[model samples]
Target: MNSLKHHILSGLFMWVLSMQAQQRPNILWINADDLGLELGCYGNLDLKTPNIDRLAKQGVLYKRAYATAPICSASRSSMITGMYPTSVNSQDHRTINMTPLPDGIEPITTYFRRAGYFCSNGNSHNMSRGGKGDFNFLAENIFDGTDWRQRKEGQPFFAQVQIHEPHRDFVKDKEHPISADKVTLPACYPNHPLLRADWAMYLESVQACDKQVGIILDRLEKDGLAENTIVFFFGDNGRPHLRDKQFLYEGGLQVPLIVRYPDHFKSKVIEKELVSLIDVSATSLELVEIKLPNYLQGNIFLGKKASKREFVYGFRDRAGDAVENMRSICNGRYKLIWNRTPDRPWMQLSSYKKAQYPAFSLYNVLYKKGELAAPFNQFMVATKPEIELFDLKKDPLEFNNLADSKKYQKIKEQLFQEISTQMVAFEKNRIPEGEKTIEKAKASSLKYYVEKIKTHNPLFTADTTDEELLKDWENRLLKK
Candidate 1:
């Protein structure tokens, strides 16, 4: 009888062990900035990105994935909070780093830690660059390039790493052609060599980021954590160029979202389902059995058949704030952009409108002289038709603004209602004014970006000696 009992208990134990092993899978989230669907898996052969491509092959690729906001601060804020920018009231456009991660919101890291997982991250972007909020990475601004293996041991761990190599700084190369000759132009932008070269440089930055991603994945396999981890790769927002980063167009708000889970999720799949970065926090929480909070607006994208968000919304606010700056609202298929300050230079607002692009400068001179007036000049002049709408199918580049057209009234009406509803919600739940109201709030928000925007007086002049305000500005920016 004792021998028989022992046999039964041993068999039962084995069965329970199998069940537990099948249930818990480690999670690793790798977020890159401005990287679009130009991967080998996404079908761009100009660059060689094997590791990330491997993850896409093994997991699922969400082709129509999007960021909640076009700019860095707002988009990242949406990701950390699991709520739309307006819902959080942090959608002031670019002041994300102006405040600490909002209070009462549980960051993904904190949630994972509560659920018995260790977390760490690596990112090189200026912490002030984004609204670096309350997601609990162990240390800020300190993740070395590719040393993810040195994190704590004994328990299953989750690591979220960020790579910014593909941002703006480095984008010049050859053979891996990202230049003008092979450039695809959005009708909003003029197709010229300078624009093409500019686009190529940005693409190169993305490819360089891929090389780093490959190295990190190799570390995972080499360290024996390959089978136990889940890998998710995505961009922070759209590309960093003019219309891409600050606008509500497809190129600016839509990002490539890919996920690779070990054996639990293995297959080449494309999910037409729309998922927002905001949902990432909730999804991570659900994976670890932590209760997803009620305050969060994001739902888990668990490949489960019952996810509830029909359309994703995006936000844009206070880009430069001089004039022509505005806010936007996007539902996966259609987007509405509102220009509150319309007198600003439209084309000059773009980061790519450099003097290096002789044609651009020539056009700018003509525009100022009242000679050139197309959509480009109209855009630079902060021209507004109240609501700008686009159908993603016909114009993936989002160049043609269809708000004033006779046919798209239904589209405009539908989006207007959605944007109004979400904005009301955002104002209610966001943080307090915190010892400041209007003017002070603006200063607080503009602490980091103000120097560049406010340059006409004592600085921004060519005669001034070299200044160290960059460092001082960075430090002040971080404190707020």
Candidate 2:
């Protein structure tokens, strides 16, 4: 009888465990566009992000999280697929249309969907354009719908909510406006009123983003899903500033990451693991007990089989209206940037970047007036070294390039060899060419997009079109 009782108890325990697995928690991914680790929780006292701060306090905050690429579509594409943008031929800042993913590779959402999880690109309200998770690949088959509301009853969900706040055209908050005088400026930028105002406006947008985060959390609680939901928050790329956006600097590549894994993880813990945004897919898969596919290059940094990465890689390709190539590798303390197009100037003309970009325009004015200083003028440098290295510990701003230093030559060669090996492993082109071909493609793509817009709205002619309008059209076209 005792033996029978033992068997029954064991069966009951197995049944309980099976039920827990069946009730697999929902995954909520919140990504902020063009944002860095500038929140209150990240020790930035300038911005008021109490809601995000609270979330960080209740979760695991990563201090050294980096994005695979620094531009929007490239970074997001790399992020969603767990593949480098260059490897998938999506390294460009924006594509003419929704470029399909490379052969035999599918979005990470496909795996979630296959595992009986309803995959969505927004919240659970069926709101369109709910979040701007702009990846270069098409999303028609990836997202079952805009939100998890379309899912069958009793099914779990994996949802991504993108916050477009703190991007360009920073909307001000009159109720609690962040004063320009109180805002702290990056030493690289000038202490001009316009620059300060730009910084203040960005802080206000951050506040707005925090409020949105609070709303999402409240909605989860209202729906009685908070206890069983794993919420992940991170930035899609870096800050929206000129040097911080498309460049491979610390300000461009590093982003904030917070994860609240329901009851599984300890609260208020700071995780200092060297993590890449591409790792998000692998981490989520492990958390959900799904086997990761072989094609994914990202390492899992959570759950029972977590592993730490020694170095994080970054890539930069063609930006809007310009063709360029740059690659970077960072091993937490030191960083190396390889500029394939060293002859090109930093301030290449991009209709999208120049329009509605306050910092870029202001910097251009400063450059013309010969008022730009030190690191601020670095953005306008006509020629850069083919390879640049920095000891991030000593030069936080990355102003001094130690690539040419005799003492650091050994370190520079090591990083160069390491990065080069990685590039070969990923099948990345060490030397990019055909600048004229790329520019032609951009012009053809833009012309085709303008024609399409004109078809719908007859008033959107070449003469009548404004730079802002063109920028929006380009964005829409790139997303297809």
lDDT (Cα, tens digit) per residue for candidate 2, span 1-480: 999999999999866754554579888898887888789998889878988998888889999999988888888888788888876667776555445666788888888877778888873223565556667665567777776666777678898887778776677777678878888888767887666767777788888778788888887788888888889999888988767888899888999999997778887655556999999988888888877889898998878999989999988888766677889998888899999899988787655555445566566666777978877787787788999899888998888899888999888888899998888867552224355657776776566545654653656654433344534433432232
Computed on alpha carbons, the lDDT of every model, listed in order, comes to 0.61, 0.78
**Global fold similarity of model 1 (TM-score):** 0.75
Instruction: Please name the candidate that would achieve the greatest TM-score relative to the true structure.
Output: 2
Q: Per model, how many backbone clashes are there? A: 16, 0
User: Could you estimate the TM-score for every candidate?
Assistant: 0.75, 0.85
lDDT, candidate 1, 79-195, per-residue tens: 766777655556654443354444576555666655555555645232213322332111243222223444444455666667775665555445465644665644556664445
lDDT of 2 at 244: 81
Cα lDDT of candidate 1 equals 0.61
Minimum summed lDDT over a 10-residue window in model 1 is located at 130-139
